[model samples]
Structure formats: C-alpha cells, structure tokens
Target: MGITGTRQAYEFPAGGAPPLGEVRAWLRQQLSDVGRGTMADTELLTTELVTNAHEHADGVAELRVSVASDRDVVRVEVDDRRPHLRPRRVTKQDPTTPHGRGLALVEAISTEWGVATGTEYKTVWAEIPVL
Candidate 1:
C-alpha cells in the first residue's frame, strides 16, 4: 500500500482480490473524517466491487481507494486485466441465495459509479458520498 495526498493504492501481483477485511480496514483508516455510516457504506461498496472483479473479470490487478480533496466523496476502483468483462445488475434476485446481489448493492449505495476500459484492463469504480 502507498499513500500520496488523499489517495492510496494497492497492486496485486497474484491477480486476485485481496482479503475483504484488510481492504475495509485500509479504507476506514483513510476516512478518519467521515462518520460511521459513511464508512460502512464505503466498505460495503468496495467489497462488492472487488469481489465482483475477482469472480467475473478473471481477477483483480489493482485496487485504488481515494477520498476527494474536499472530502465530498470516497471513490473505490477495482482494476482487472480482462477488459471485456463488465459489471451487470441482477434484476431478479432469489431470497435464499447469497450470490448475484453485489452490483445491486453498489447501485443502491453509490452516489456515482461506472466502468472504464483500457486496451488490456477494465476498472470498475464507485463513489460514496461522505456524510
């Protein structure tokens, strides 16, 4: 992990998601100014993005977590080598199942979110407002 200004990034050589607990703790530490509610939302959304990339986009290549200079939002991005894969929201969810609800949680909680693709990688990102 490296930090500069308001941003911190982690690069994974093994090409997979890092442990969710570690990521959440890192994010929480970065967000000292935010309330517990905002921190929870950020953690949950970041976990969803990372988990989705690991499961669907081959694996995660990097994870970037940044807070706006003005502290208006915290943005979490998960990058993967597979540029062809993108996140999709599941319209129909089964009550008994634990899968297929990540993107839906992202959509509901993130203030803004989207994907960016390069020649060899795609980054799925979400921004949660600081409250």
Candidate 2:
C-alpha cells in the first residue's frame, strides 16, 4: 500500500510569524497515520521554512505539506510573494552572530532542501525520508 496525501493551502501575512505550535498540532492531526518520527521532522522543518519566509520576505506567505509513500518522502514548502530574496547556504565563520542560522539547521535535519523560484514568488522546500 502506498500513502499519498496533501493538505490545503495555508496563507499567512508576509513578515508575520505564525504560531508554530498551532501549525504543528494541525500537521500532527493531518499526518496521524504516518510515522511519528517523520511527522515530527516534517513539522520542525516546516516551521523553519515558514519562519524564514515570515521574517525575511514581504507580501504574503503560503505553506503546503505533502506526503508520498511511493517516493518514501515527505515534503514541506513555504512560499513567499517576494522573489528577490533568494535562499542561500550561509557559511559563517563566527559562531557568535545574533542571527542567520536557519538554512543550516534545515540542511542538517532534512534529507534535501532547496529553493524554487517562479515569476512572482519563491518557495523554499525541504524533504525528509519517511523510512
């Protein structure tokens, strides 16, 4: 049996932080049939991507969570109206910086993650294996 499901679009104000707890709870309920570890990781990565969109971009932000058992992966994407702020891997020498560590954490946890840019918006996405 293969699992495949997707949640409806969630829209939030740009540069405005959404409640992480609420998002996690909703995701938990949606993915209840899925494994707990995979669900937890997906929720954490989703929060990171969404938080980045809210803090760094402007206009509006949207989120989508998709699970594909055939592909053995769960993907989370955060879309923002601003396409100018490209997502990049930060290489910081000083560890004392007050900010700029989100991408690093995302990379450390997710199996793979990157940005997809379109004509009007950009989506930062991360995928974690469900095995």
Candidate 3:
C-alpha cells in the first residue's frame, strides 16, 4: 500500500530530545510499507539531520516526516532554533575528523534537499525517492 498523505510530527520535549535510536525506530515503524532499502536510507538521512540539529543548533524544535501524494518520495524535515545556521555540504571532508560529514551524506543520498529559515528557527529537509 502507498503512504500518500501520511504524515507524522514530533516535537521535542522540555527535558531533552529523544534518543537517536528511538527516532530511528519510530521512523522505521512509520515507513514500514516502503522497501527495506528505502526505509534504511530514510533512517540514515533522518538521523544525520537530527544529529546535526542537536550538535549545532542546541536542540531540535520539531521533526516532520511525510509521504508525497504520488507516493514517489518521502520528505524528512528537522527544525532547530537557530535560523542563521543553514546546513551546507562539506566539499572537502577530512578522513581524520568525524565532524562535518552529516550534510555531505545528506547531499549524496537525498534526491533534493534544502533549508527553510523562519524568524526564530531553521529547518533542514531532505527528500528521498521511494524505490
């Protein structure tokens, strides 16, 4: 069955953001109807975005996952409090360092991705095509 019009939103709690594993689990459950490969790709990209938000922007304000009407793509968006810090892919990554590879991974795997800046927050979104 297709997941058209299916959407889920997660707002960060007051205490702290949920564990990355929990987020992945939730996403896996939500996208279970998609192919395994597609679900894995979505989890990886979603984790990257959530990790970036926690590491760079203090914390994530919300997370949204939605399937397009045509069921051709899944969109994952992570919103953070810092509007000025837009995500960008690292052109030159250092093998020695573990930092700065998140956006690069997102760029490589996502069919299309971009940042949306609100007055008080910014959202990094990626679209993964369903295979």
Candidate 4:
C-alpha cells in the first residue's frame, strides 16, 4: 500500500446510527494530514460506503485508509458488524435511484472494489487510482 506514504485508520461506534457527515470530515482530515488531496471520487465513494453502513449494517468497526507513496492510488474500507448481510451488487444503475441509494456510483468511480465478510463483520472497500 505504501512504503512511506499513508496508512491510517479510524473507529466509530456502531450503536444506533452512523454519522455520515462526521465520518466524511474525518476522512478528509486524515487524507489532508498525509498530504493527499481528498479528491471528489475518493470522497464520494467513501461516503457511499459509509451511508450504506449507516442505513443497513448493525455496527461499524472501523474505516481504514491506505495510500500509495506517490499518492496516485488510495484504498478506503468501511467495516461493519453484519457478516451475514453483506452488501449486494448492483448490476445496473437506475437512472431514477431515489436520492442516493445504490452501489452503482461506487461501481463506476472505484478502480476496483469488493466485500470481505468474516464471522462477525463485513467490509466494503473501494480503491481509487489517479489517472
């Protein structure tokens, strides 16, 4: 992920609801602290994952960030407690998807992404690489 670039993590309580705005701000700060720009794509994708966790998942364990030395690539992960209910894949983007309630955008912006489900939790991660 990085030789001497960025590798950081944040933990949030997954009691009642996940605070989307707070999470975003923290992410931006972390990126900025490491001299990463917090580009639009990274911001948007991370928000999506967090929102999903807020709405569907039961508990959020952590948010991890990893950046390449050149800062040309970054990976963000949202880990939540709900291994059984992993994120579902959205094959098509519905033009009229309410306000924002789908993985379609994540699928579009992420360079690569997937879900990791363990016994007690599941993580939805997306990687954004600068072109």
Best candidate according to lDDT: 3
lDDT agreement of model 1 with the native: 0.81
Model 1 per-residue lDDT tens digits across residues 1-131: 12224567876658444687877877777676778898899889988888888888787888888877565777888898899876777898899997999999999999889999999999999988877
RMSD of 3: 1.6
Lowest lDDT block of 10, candidate 1:
1-10
What lDDT score is found at residue 10 in candidate 1? 74
TM-scores for every predicted model = 0.87, 0.85, 0.92, 0.79
Ranking by TM-score: 3, 1, 2, 4
Question: Could you give candidate 3's per-residue lDDT for residues 29-126 as a string of tens digits?
Answer: 77778888889899999999998999889888888998895758999999999999877668887899969988888988899999999999898999
The parts of candidate 4 lying over 4 Å away from their true place are: 1-6, 33-38, 92-101
Best by TM-score: 3
lDDT on C-alpha atoms for all candidate structures = 0.81, 0.77, 0.86, 0.75
Q: How well is each residue in 1-131 modelled by candidate 2, as lDDT tens digits? A: 12366555666643445878878887776667678788878787877787787777863367777786667788788888888789778886468986678888899889888888998999888888885
Score candidate 2 by TM-score against the native. Answer: 0.85
Please give, for residues 1-131, the per-residue lDDT of candidate 4 as tens digits: 23236568888874767777787787677666334444567788888888788788866788888777665677888898888896777655567767444587898888789998899889899988754
Error of 2 at 69 (Å): 1.9
What lDDT is reached at residue 17 by model 1? 46
